[model samples]
Target chain A: MVNSWLELGAQKKDTPVKHNYSIFRRNCLMGIVLAVLLMSGPQRSWGQSEKPSIDFFSGFEVGLYDFYFYQKYNVVFNLTPGFKWNMGNHWQLAGQARLTVINQLSNDVRRFYPSMLVLSKELKAGPVYLKGSVGAFSNSRYGFDLKAFLPVTPWLAFEAQAGLTGLLTMAGGWGMSPMGRFTGTVGGDIYLSRWNTQLRGVVGKYVYTDWGFQAEAMRHFNHATVGLYAKWNNIAGQLGQEGVSLTQSLAKGMDGGFKVTIMLPPYKRTHRTVNFRPASHYSLTYLVRGMAQYRDANQLYYTDPEENMRDGWFSRDLLKWGSHTMEPDFIYKGKEETE
Target chain B: MKRIKISYILLAAMVLLPSLSHAQQYNGTSGFLHIPSAEMSHEGDARMGVHYLNKALLPDTGFLFQGEKYNTYDFYLGITPFEWIELSFTSTRRKDTRAVTGEVGFWRKDRYASIKIRPLREGRYHPAVAIGFNDVGTTAFNKERTDVQLYFTNIYVAATKHFGFGGNELGVNLAYRHYFRNYNDKWSGLVGGLSFRPAFFPQGRAIVEYMGNEFLIGADALLWQHVLIQASLIDFKYLNLGLCLQLNMLGKKYVVAER
Candidate 1:
């Protein structure tokens, strides 16, 4: 069959195959260049930006724990000039220089730290999406992190994540602790399509070597998300290191709170190579500390800057949202699927 | 004679009637003088302010200049992310103070946060009600850095009712303030205030409030709906002043220009 086809193709090769193939290749190249130019900046909305995003960012942090009559507050203004440059082949380099504009901490001058300098890659395994990152992260940690997400059904998804990090602080100079603590989480989510509600539960080992669980219920809105979360940890592993017995660890680790995340405007924009705007989403959490507890037990930090329930952060459903609408519809087959 | 006295009392209450509120309170929520009110700016409403706190209104952390100075300052940024919620971060500069612990400083700064939740809107049948925490978790160390003191920490509920009479308006506010963590609870008790906005001067509010231990009279004016300027007489004796700029980054404009 191959010999017969080769003789037939050799006889036709003299005809105009080469010229037509050259023109077709040239047109495809031009089309790709045109698309890249059109999608260079965050125009009209965040979802439309297809090219690398170089944006100016700012956020504020308030520290209330260090207050005393002598020094009441530490209000730091974080200025992050960051870039997410796609290095191609699903690998990217994202980083930010967190400069301090105002730091009223302990009568000392303001200080700046390097934040979120990571080289990350995205991969797909069958139906699951996986991501790995390495470099300095927020919460003063530096190391490597891995994540996997799978959407088994339209209304359910599972996620697994792990991080090996060490303490890095820029306070009073630069210092970094050895990377030894390994932390990981396993979680699943139930998506209620009709109500635009989601419920999530996760069990994880924290950086402090304590085991814990988190439960959250969130409501999705067009531009915002509101949710309540409860976190509980076993004091056993960490407290045992301090000389306390297993019985003393008990159930003392409990913290619950409400969170609100909102997307800021210019929801849509004209094209530009690099854009300047506020942080895409501002999320605020109000923690409830009961009378008995001196402080919260859970020491959790976000591995990804975009981690939030509003985007269903660790779920594949996020891939279906935003450019079209806040509520994903393609995968959310309502009553028809049940029927 | 007794009937005449009762009639005069009723007339006094009627004259001291009610005012509207936006988020221009001196301590930076919606209210009058040094207290918080049951009002909030629209979602996305943000304000940055600098205030000159009078000596009498300062937290009772005794210093060498406690009675002689009215020069402490503060800068705050407040925003309303939800229509019912208001959040703010404030840093107060304690200037030129010598603590009893033998420590002296020219610029000692303290930071605190405040939150307000407006659950009920004012209607003909009921007043607007709000629950708030002011400096909820603020504690400062003494000069020795050994002793800790909670400063300006308060939890309060405020109710405000607005009465309109041909463009001129009045607002009556009553609240109960509790010291959540502190030894000296100066402004922690029943507090009430009255606000009047004359029809001719729609941009300004004249207010008077008895803040538990002291009486304060103040007036705030909105300039071009964004710039807010305020002046007050603390305990009817010393002067306090404030200036703030309100910025609405998204959604609708924070204030409707009545003109």
Candidate 2:
């Protein structure tokens, strides 16, 4: 009699499962609607001038373990399509919409995070670039981030960022009690023609961290860029006082990963490429390198030929000094060389 | 309501004034992307151009929503003094809101000069190269807004190549621009565009531009011998329209077919 009573109770408990199904259906529908709307524009070739263009991006990443959830072996899938708009010579706006799906292989659990929207504004002035955005992350966290990049010299640039976010607990009993937090990053980029390195110090709530340091290096190829990053968190390991393993702090933790990005062509012209030039047009090796490559010095060293001619004034005579006889008469053609 | 009435009145005047001129010449070298072109206007030709940009279409909510009506008006007087050089003076007025405060009471007016120079001609394989300075003229104010410097300035250099295949012609232009200002002063970005005329519409042409950060789609059509109409959708939100009047300030010439 008791076993029959329990069976009846189990059948009565189907309402919650039905409710969860309804929520999942709603989210899927929303994603489909957004995808359709973004892809509905005219099919003509675009991004040819000072206007806005649309592009789509997707990424898949596998993590050995989730630092925050303490889950072993998880995979993340991201789909993002964005519109980039140029306001003027100095300003740009980008609307980024992203959907993320996280799957944990160990427990055979799958979770779908809500779509996120981010509007980022970028401004450039002289040697400084500023980027700020207000958006929600796929983790059901809403936030704003402000970042600035300042080029102290041609080969070195400093970057700083600060963000504020409010987290919401979700499936798997993770992120319980959802609290507000602040995060900051300070970094610098070292650039070479084909390679770049970033060293950053991060402090905030990312997989439970009071602070962390990261070093990343990327190599650029003709059509793709490959990068690897290593991170060390919380120099001192700290455990949560009252929480499960999922909420336990991952301080003093270490992790590393590799990423590859492929660029599609009919590429847009933007500062992302030009800013990599080395500072000081008078670098001795740059000229020799240009000559060795049989590249046009005008095209390689300057944005405009007129500017190239003017800049060559500095290194031209230097190049001629060793090439031709450095006679006093040849050197004193004008006193402006010394003045 | 009063502001809307004044806008209508101004637009009507702009459309009417172009009809007063009786020059039987339309300009073939007048089209530009969002920025001025490296190509000059017809030699010794002068024109008055007006442009209106309305950035008030997005809803007040989403990430792309621009809260208030942000509108701009640009009036340009452009002249081609030499076969390879063009000069333009522009008066621009903008009405926007304070970034932090939502009040729509902010307004600014700036007068600037634009200069373009074409140094190389198109050859069988080599493209035509042109260089230009955008918004070069400004009265001395703060160092940040100074426009006279060349390095880290608003300079754009472009190279255009024309390709003809089976009677269809397409012009591809690639440009590099560097701007010197706070936060935007250090680096340069690449932007390019394609210009072509449709077979069905011989009198009209379309320009598609990727200005590094955004994309612009627009069309320019000749309404009359001396009148040209220009319209564009900026970022798929604002509808920008323009009316240009060409006049023979110094010599007589008619629009020539683009080569």
Candidate 3:
């Protein structure tokens, strides 16, 4: 069982006992020499040929926000469930499993859990695609990401990503104290899968400091799927406390909302999978208007006058597949199913 | 004792000569815990660590916990012969924690080495440079101390609909550090920050740093399915809060290949 949970995590307690047992026996002898070099290298032809098929997705997402300058705008909710697997032939392999819940319409309410691993590749013509990702966020920090995508057709697409995240301490514990940062994003995605709709727009900048923008639109009928989201963040310079120079900090606001999803598939389909159909989803979002401003350029303080509007619901029954599975199902009834 | 057996055979030949060559495109594993700075006076120190990176261990090994005013407990090892080169080895058993009190059990040990560089390649906002060296031995009233360290890195880029967000990550970074004697002069300064990972926490993230002057806020919560949980809170001048945990070694691949 994964080497007895890595031998009980090398007997826990801040590990390091004999160098984590020689790094778990050198990663189990490098996983038996990469499984005997992929069972004696060189050998193809195994399901799906043609080399132009990249489709993998794992779901579960919940979000709600209303933080316009901290005045009655605190209703942040999140629940992410991910998995995106696509290999060779074209290339795409993503993964996810996140959970976040923050309620601050008034103040105090936090929770988070993140998991990710992604790699995407596709370029020919223009719809460009190139991605890379590294994970670790709830186990205790360490992240890396990269991105590039451009598809002005087949729906619409455009993207960009950056990286460097932190956390790696061994003396404190509220979660460790190592917060490194650096990020950038630009977005575009619009797919109307025959009214199944999907519209997105993003704009962010955290360089000289801060700026935010977000938009979402989803509509998938015949089982249920409805969404509409928006966002606008601010804070683009001057911020130094003890030594002064708060430069008005900066804070703007906006948030619209509407989410209604209902999907519950799976009665029994023993086999015959081309994207295994099994669903169960739910959502409720509502946040009307928000505002913020503690210092606009210098001295103009404005962080009150915040209106109230909040509502965020969530639900997930789990079980949805379709990443090329030939007899996949590791204990579905007893739970436990991952590829 | 023969230089502690040649520093454990050069830290086991710098961690098995990069897994004997080739193999390591992405393999990570992490775990951490370290708490010092109870406002000085040799505060109730504490330590614990773990790390592993692939491509022939580009970055590997580190274990620490030498509390009781540096009584004993410290072990570190990092290697990366190529790909910009990097080497490190730190050992400790204690010798001076405010000039030892009254010899309780007696102890002494130390070691060090470091070198890092990334002259471009691996872009998305590149800039890296590093250098370090340490060897503190002699006991009973000082007598052995070797030092030298310097680093300068930068980051600043953007994504996520330029300003309209959802899922896509947004970027920002600005780093700086300098030290050459003064043995950790107030830990140097100027460390910028800013980050946000959306897309439903694709591994989760939300960081903000501004070192040397204070203001460090962090978050990385991905519990299970590879595991993670890093947290932080720093108030410059002095004031800290931390937490750690991470593990994700190999397994999880696919570097673009779907057309």
Error of 3 at A237 (Å): 3.7
Query: For candidate 1, lDDT tens digit of each residue in B51-169?
Result: 87777777666323645544577887776756788877676776654456656554476556778999998878799999988764442112223354456667889999988887778
In angstroms, give how far residue A148 of model 3 lies from its true place.
15
- Span of ten consecutive residues with least summed lDDT in model 3 chain B: B36-45
Per-residue lDDT of candidate 1, residues A164-186 (tens digit) = 66665554356454455578999
What DockQ results for candidate 1?
0.10
Per-residue lDDT tens digits of candidate 3, residues B97-179? 22335433323333332233444432434423322222211121122234212111112121111122554554344434443
Q: Across residues A97-151, which tens digit of lDDT does each residue of candidate 3 receive?
A: 4345543332322254334443433323223443333443222333444456565
- Cα lDDT of all candidates, in order? 0.62, 0.44, 0.34
Candidate 1 overall lDDT versus native: 0.62
Best by lDDT: 1
Please write out the lDDT profile of model 2 over residues B1-259, one tens digit for every residue. Answer: 5655554454344333432121111112343546434445555566677766454311121112254445556676665645686666565554444455555532433445566789997788988888877555322222464443322126778888777654445778788877655334323588777876544444555667776666766666655556767655555444567777765533355543444
TM-score of 2: 0.34
Interface RMSD of 2: 23.0
